[model samples]
Target: MNGVDPLGTGVPGPREARARARAGTAGPTAGWAPGHAQANLIAVPADWAYDVLLFCTRNPKPCPVLDVTDAGSWTTSLAPGADLRTDIPGYRVWEDGRLVAEPADATPHWRTDLVSFLIGCSFTFEGALDAAGVPLRHVEQGRNVSMYVTDRACRPAGRLHGPMVVSMRPVPARLVPMARRISGLLPAVHGAPVHAGDPAALGIRDLDRPDFGDPVVAEPGDVPVFWACGVTPQAAVMASRPPFAITHAPGRMLVTDVRDEEYRLTL
Candidate 1:
């Protein structure tokens, strides 16, 4: 790959983005690697792997499974030669359902009994909406997109259960339709907005405060659009309290080699 600005918005290709991410210098990945698919990481003990995968299978909207690594492997087909232990800009180490550490490099925390899952992230579809002339407030403010955990519960699967989490993007009322239409085509990446206009409908009482990510300022006439977020798995770990787990810190995604169009459905 030719040299490019590693931290420039919409500049670096997937490989360059990963290189920057691995260095822990890339800022929030909400809009990086424009055309590449980004993913959420959730690694659990081998014994808990099947349950996690089943949870994703049962709750596809908030937990769309993109790739799964064999127990003990850190590399994924999503990004050949990429190291799950350190490629992402950030990671959350969990023990008994509580966040124990926020590490940029998780290599020292790796375990042979762990199996990793890469779930579809809404960030992968931001470029689509951007191309459609839809406004993205988080990208505009250079902030992490807001995410909230809802009162809505996901279908429980063997040993795992939790509330669904959603990412919020404020879109101009008129462009809401275009944003939805374009994003709805990419089901692999959380698809269409699960809710728009009212945050209370999802039990989110405050638009100013979010469970994960920084809330951005919404412009007048901009409606809050909510989409199923990949962070739901972390919510699961919080609720289920597995012995141990590792997940991508909210808004910090694994930039994969897969192109975003690969997951978009045609008309």
Candidate 2:
């Protein structure tokens, strides 16, 4: 973390997080670098870029597009010096719609014809909920937030289409409303809980075994809150199976220089 500003602003920033990732010391990015925005990454061939972009636009809630890099470029305006090929702690390599590898660095698989996209993440709103005194079960238990594949299907765009995926957070019944308000302010980060209190409504029969990420034990009096997850695009891409693709490992994200406040959009 030498070149990274670990103490800048008296808080851990994206650079520090990326450095930890590069050093192979980084774990889940959910609780790290509080207050800074985190993003989900997906890289695809230029030929599929239009469909991917359209897929995101059609499913804004789950696939909010933040920053997109030019073909073959690893750099983005989100993080000046960060390299997309190596900054994330983990990467998932997919072939023919099946996940083939989960590597720490994607440098070896870098392609000159690839187009990378940064999608809004729900992790960015966790800090706000923490500040508001809302309990986060996953953070408290040191586990990744639970995510599930819902019966809800996203609007199809070209060759991309799949069920909507969501991240589940157990918020206290009393704080559920407050959580919505606090998170609702940040549209760029998958703002607010799309559903609360009923897991069955989303086709999540057992919360203990999630479709992705770790199961967060819901405590007494806690209600399960669901947010549109960035992973939705990965699911869509996987179902469509674009021959070759790469995405950040579930729960692992690319921390960005953009502050959480920057994503707060208002009418």
Candidate 3:
């Protein structure tokens, strides 16, 4: 809260971060509030809650459930005073499974029947890697981390079924092992790298082009690392084409009161 953000420049803490996010000033929570846990947002009608829960249960890596709000409630235990309707920097509104709007706030579309979910995000682990002296190119360049939809399919749960999505980071070859070990401690935040070294094995043909978020050039001797992404749920919603849905924009995340250390598992 006092020093510069882990990414270098000074950014807001949880409260200020959410405030800036609601005001559309903060771009992404990547390096903001380094010690705090960041979350992915997904809201759906009560009718689809069971299916969604099952989907998350079946695919824990990409959809680790941090908190699930009661039907019609936008408030979450993650941030008691914050409102999900406006705290995120950006949102994606879906209708009939198609993204209809990308807005700064979704208050205009908020409904009493909607249930919001908070999913653990890889941003938490990125902070750990940074603290351990691993520099993240996406954050260094002030861009969203590159995310891609892979050929691998997530196990279906009821009506939700979609391909897996992964966020890519270029780690110096010598530091890849350290990066993996540091991230592995936080299982609640997508854990360790799902794949490293080769993008082709994951069906990713071009590292310069991504399905979501911005792309960063991998320098010579940099190994491409991939982690299961929370965006996988958004892809599921797109494939399932639910009647209505809401999700956080690519890099925008729900800054929570929880600390990143709370998510680090001993095993």
Candidate 4:
């Protein structure tokens, strides 16, 4: 019901988005390929792979790992025939926990010792949310979703540790419950809203000044809703200082071949 908009939105289906990304079209992927499961990418050295896996296991909400690749391998079951190094629009290259480069194609930076993890992304459920009549302000405004680092810290695993990061979406007050329930069905993609009222409750001070992504404007009666973000791993990379790592640029994601319904739970 997504790529084709089963709700009769007449939106074309098929994941040509990856083709564009592979061809070097760099940008965030909020509404790129409807109905397809999108994922967050993070690759670390083989030695640090277990620590990252354990971290994701400990912080499932923020790091719902969909797939993990063998050392030096870029292919994933999530998207057959797709190359991890160049399929995503953009990538963040890190050295000693500090970001060193933002590359369109990570093939040059790819290493034989790196292992990649594909984490579930909130964008995967956006089609259902839209079909349910929930507004997507960032999509409507052509902006990336707003994300912030909170005071809440994640459970440490081995060498990986950091505060939680959340993506904020402004939903109409009356539709907040509907929004929560719809997203709740996709547990792999950070199911449900973590907070749905005051940003301060999460220690996020200024809505306009987010730690990552673009700040979206809210229409009248809209309330800010927060969801645990896959970017939490990147925050950990920044805080814990992994020797070397690569990640999908904030907001940009790996659009997998898996359908949105595959991860959906019947209510």
Residue 53 local lDDT, model 2: 96
What are the Cα lDDT values of the candidates?
0.90, 0.87, 0.89, 0.91
Model 2 poorest 10 in a row by lDDT? 1-10
* Number of residue pairs clashing in candidate 2, backbone atoms closer than 3 angstroms, sequence gap of 3 or more or interchain: 0
lDDT of 1 by residue, 156-227 (tens): 999999999999999899999998899999999989989998898999999899999998999999999999
- Measured with C-alpha atoms, the lDDT of residue 53 in candidate 4 is 99
Show model 1 residue runs off by greater than 4 Å. 1-6
Ranking by TM-score: 1, 3, 4, 2
lDDT of 3 by residue, 62-84 (tens): 88999999999989998879999
Model 4 segments more than 4 A misplaced:
1-15
Best by TM-score: 1
Q: Which model, 2 or 4, shows the larger lDDT?
A: 4
* lDDT tens per residue, model 4, 1-267: 223322123442335677778887666788777878999999999999999999999999999999999999999999888899998989999999999999999999999999999999999999899999898898887788999999999999999999999999999999999999999999999999899999999999999999999989999999999999999999999999999999999999988999999999987
Poorest lDDT segment (10 consecutive residues) of candidate 3: 1-10
Ranking according to lDDT, highest score first: 4, 1, 3, 2
Clashing pairs in model 3, backbone N/Cα/C closer than 3 A = 97-241
Off by over 4 Å in 3: 1-9
Q: Which one wins on lDDT?
A: 4
RMSD of every candidate to native, in Å, equals 2.6, 3.6, 2.0, 3.0
